[model samples]
Target chain A: MQQVIQANLKDNDNIEPVFSHFETQLNGERSSAWHQKRKAALEELKSLTYPTTKNEEWKYTNIAKVLANDYAFNAPSDLTKEEISKFSLSELEAHKLVFVNGIFREEFSDYSSEKGLHILSLKAAYQAHADLIEAHFSEIASTKEEPFTALSTAFAFNGVFILAEKSAVASKPIFILNITDTSDYPVIAQPRNLVIARENSEVTVIEDFVSVGGKPAFLNYVSEFKVEQSAKVDHYKLQNKGDNNFYIGTTQVHQSDKSNYNNTVATLGGGLIRNNLNILLDGEYCEAFMNGLYMLKDKDHVDNHTMVDHLKPNSYSNEMYKGIMDGHSTGVFNGKIYVRQYAQKTNAFQENKNILLSENATVDTKPQLEIWADDVKCSHGATTGALDEEPLFYLRSRGIGEDKARALLMNAFAEDVISRIKSETFKSHIETLISNRLENR
Target chain B: MLEIKNLHASVEDKKILNGISLKVNAGEVHAIMGPNGSGKSTLASVLAGKEDFEVEEGEALYNGQDLLDMSPEDRAREGIFLAFQYPVEIPGVSNTNFLKTAINEIRKYKGEEPLDAVAFLKKMKEKMKLVNIDQSLMSRSLNEGFSGGEKKRNEIFHMAMLEPKLAILDETDSGLDIDALRIVANGVNALKSPDNATIVVTHYQRLLDYIVPDFVHVLYKGRIVKSGTKELALELEDKGYDWIKKEVEEGVI
Candidate 1:
């Protein structure tokens, strides 16, 4: 395990080729504002260095090994719906947008028609609704400090773009299905997504990341959500990729007055995965709920970093994340709650709990709350330990085997976050995934 | 149905039960009364095969099978149930789901088909009446935020569901009120049949009033110093355990 310290993606030979491929996919939008944003993002990415363990933010998660591979940029796949039938949620009736190797495939995508609701690929939206794209694109997901966010912005030609117009309620959810086919060569897919829920509007988005091939694949995803005044948005990210894939994603949310935003990300499997979820409570009386569940085994590693910033008065936010690790896996949770001086009467709560089933499995959790407002209330806690011996024996004394008892306990640990899911279909789907993973491990 | 010969056990290398022998037959109820730290609960735990307790030298034969050699789950699947003194709270695991998993696993062990949802619900409905447990409590997290009386009642409900051949009630009346004790004792009495047996291990003789025992044994320093009929329980209750302790100390029992 050598720490090569791959400080800058700018020095890698793969960057130029990947940028050139991204430019070719732009389809002659060189004069557009989006192209200029990409150019500016590339320049910003060169100045930013890849994070190392020495950096406090990445102290526990060392991603140098995942980034050491030489990924191919020219990855092209023509996978059909039948090939990816295994990953489909049959009960989920929503608008389906499919992407392969970060390239939108219109033939495999279908959308539901609804008045005042606009859904398109980022590239298509730049062409049809350039004004909207120009206004929201790159506004919240800044690339100045984060190299991965910069990389995603530099190659943001293909992804999902959704806009819910004023007072428009989406009839159903919008499912963005991203699949990676690395059977040909090791590849990388950087997809940028933007979601806007206008004033008094509501929308739900499900991002399902899956991979088909065994070769090494990397998915760098960045999504921005703008929840306007009195609007509601529910976001779910299901990361169930192959064993040979790596994932790093950033979800940045901006909230307005009286808005509500709820997010749940379940990372069941992957070689290495990292998630950065940040929500800004910039308006008064906003509400945010963040829930996450990650179960890892067999050398899998996952790191989740979440931040909630309350800048206005009378806002509330609550976050709870739980993890189950076994078989030499690693899990990290870093949550920060910041209440500004003016954010009086704010209430924020954060908790992270983990269960390590094996001696080799490990977890590092840190919950930090910084409050400048004297009238605000904030609390944070983290706990990491083995399953309770009393409960384990209680289940076994009633005829459950040792393995089944452990699995039941693990499932019970995950239900805290799973119960927060509002969609029954999605909740059952997640429960199945979590239980299957727990049993197999 | 259950036989124990010179049972000796210890936890963490500290001796608890030392050289004790007892036998319980089908259709019989045996009550063991003892003072605090007199190895009453240790005997029940050892018979139930709690892993923390190591059997130093003993043989527990349940239906002529070596119960001490079997795992706790196997012992349970083989119709041996121990009602714990303190049931642990398992958050997020509903009482119904926990019972279902336990029942199905026991059924699979006995080469029987697992119960379906409809059958399970019906059985649960019937068993709830045995202990007067509410339907809402079954759907909530197991034993979480439950009152002392409610937890005890739920234990009886679980016992009714499992229907074990040998039921070991360990301090089942410790935290129960008078009404709760009556309901729980009635549940146990209703579940008793000619094909099964019961071992009531208690510190106080009050529980025996409702679910009367056929035989009473006084355990002093891990060995039965006295054995008699139901009248022995009344004597111990009226006279207290100091006389029994004095007899054991003076070798006059």
Candidate 2:
């Protein structure tokens, strides 16, 4: 046991203090069932070490340096409306919920006025809808196995809680903006979010992650979504955490019979970023779509791990993720598809393409498929290369400068994924963000 | 407007152009007729400043400026256009947007203001008639999934838009049907003026019937072995390039 602790965690003594400080803050909630789960997750976290490159799951991404730094768990922020407005998408007409440093700020949030839709902070949901919170929390995303999920389950106190009842359709999309303020000092924020779409309900959720200050910060975010029978859920995650931040995100999804789930995540900026997306098609005739794009530059690194498990028959899952890396940055893509024994007639397709602009820029991609079913149609492909010289030359010979030509090709490579986004305003917003980043690359 | 003086070029240390020279002035079209693997496309690419071909010896003077010294885009901004034999398909970049960017960048390089969106669209609509290009095709990705004839016609459309002083058409008539060839040639003829020149490099003399050249040169073994009037193209078409190959091998005029 002692050797196992030494193998997993670099400094056991540092974690002991962090956990105790968090436990002391849970004064009234110490006796709640949720706190008990948090305690159990904390124990599980103690045994799990920060992953090194030696681990198969962490092969290309090394989190040792990120773990070596000490940061404030409950970071304080003095964010004003003006400061918050800088990151706001004024063009989007969606219900907004803002979180600062893992804590929900009601003053800055606007709730949806539609009926049968409930959006609340985790604490408010705990008081108003205890049964729903207890039934779904940590159920879709088990915290006992994954290190970051367990860390988020243990330390996170506040996050967004959304529920859509039967046949309820959100008139407008819900935008959850998670802002980590590191203006004063280095910080670590863990936000646990849960979304439940009941039978025949539909909703679109946009999760935007950004940081204001230049200080080194760590954001451990976990979100679990349950798509009930015949329900539909569209999820979008856009991350631009600037130069001095490290982010680890986990998104777990469970789909019911005939449910539809669509997710699109774009990571444009971060010092080091890792995202884990897991989906379980538990019922027949369910469909899932995952589209992602990441454009990294400088020394920034982004790793995306995605898993889709077809547990029942006649399910469909498709994934397309494209990346463009410039400077000395690196990227990793590991996509897995699983078909159970009884999950016959499953159709799964996965493709990942990458473009390395600079000689030093690199990418590692792996597609894993485990099939126990006989009648499954599954295809996966991965491609990594520099920008096509033919297109570059073609553009340049037309009076477009070399830099502009490269940017044009890079943007075109990313458009397929961006075009999949349904919202015109949001799509154009993402287009602006990506085109601006590719302008001087 | 274009002068080549014993220009020598190679790709990957293998000589392709061995001391080829030609001279063209404004208001005139020159037809370069070559057999397969005779370095016809290589000459076109070298003039457009393709990086794969290294200019080993000699020089190409475009309006008295060393063409080899400029980058491909700089050469383009200076009114040198090469209509590719195989136009590349760039998905997600609309043809209109690409042409607009190219025009603005060239204008920027020439110390001129860019055309506004309204003005640019007006120009595009006017030029669309030159090649009979449909308006809907201009909104699609640049030449992606375009037919062989459509791609060739697009090259002419681009030529009309850029309005180059020296246009090098490298096998632009290849894989083109007769009607498509006529439309492309007509667009080229429509864009010709006393201030600009055209160099048509082709394997067949079929395209010359539409846009007749002032001079026809037979290129064999990396050098222009014969130079004649437009009637030379008809003579070559009737006798085939084997005669020219035999003439070159025998050192006969």
Candidate with best DockQ: 2
Clashing pairs in 1: none
Go through the candidates in order and give each one's DockQ.
0.78, 0.87
> DockQ for the candidate 2 complex?
0.87
Lowest lDDT 10-mer window, candidate 1 chain A? Answer: A1-10
Give the docking tier of candidate 1.
Answer: medium
Model 2 residue runs over 4 Å out of place are A1-28
Q: What share of the true interface contacts does each candidate keep?
A: 0.75, 0.93
Q: What is the lDDT of residue A106 in candidate 2?
A: 84
What's the lDDT for residue B136 in model 1? 88
Measured by TM-score, how close is model 2 to the native structure? Answer: 0.96
Q: Can you tell me the CAPRI class of model 2? A: high
Instruction: Please provide, for model 2 over B1-253, each residue's C-alpha lDDT reduced to its tens digit, 9 standing for 90 to 100.
Output: 7889998999999999999989999999999998999999999999998999988899989899998999999999999999999999999999999999999999999999999999998888889998899888898999999999889889999989999999999999999989999999999999999999999999999999998999999888899999999999999999999988888778895
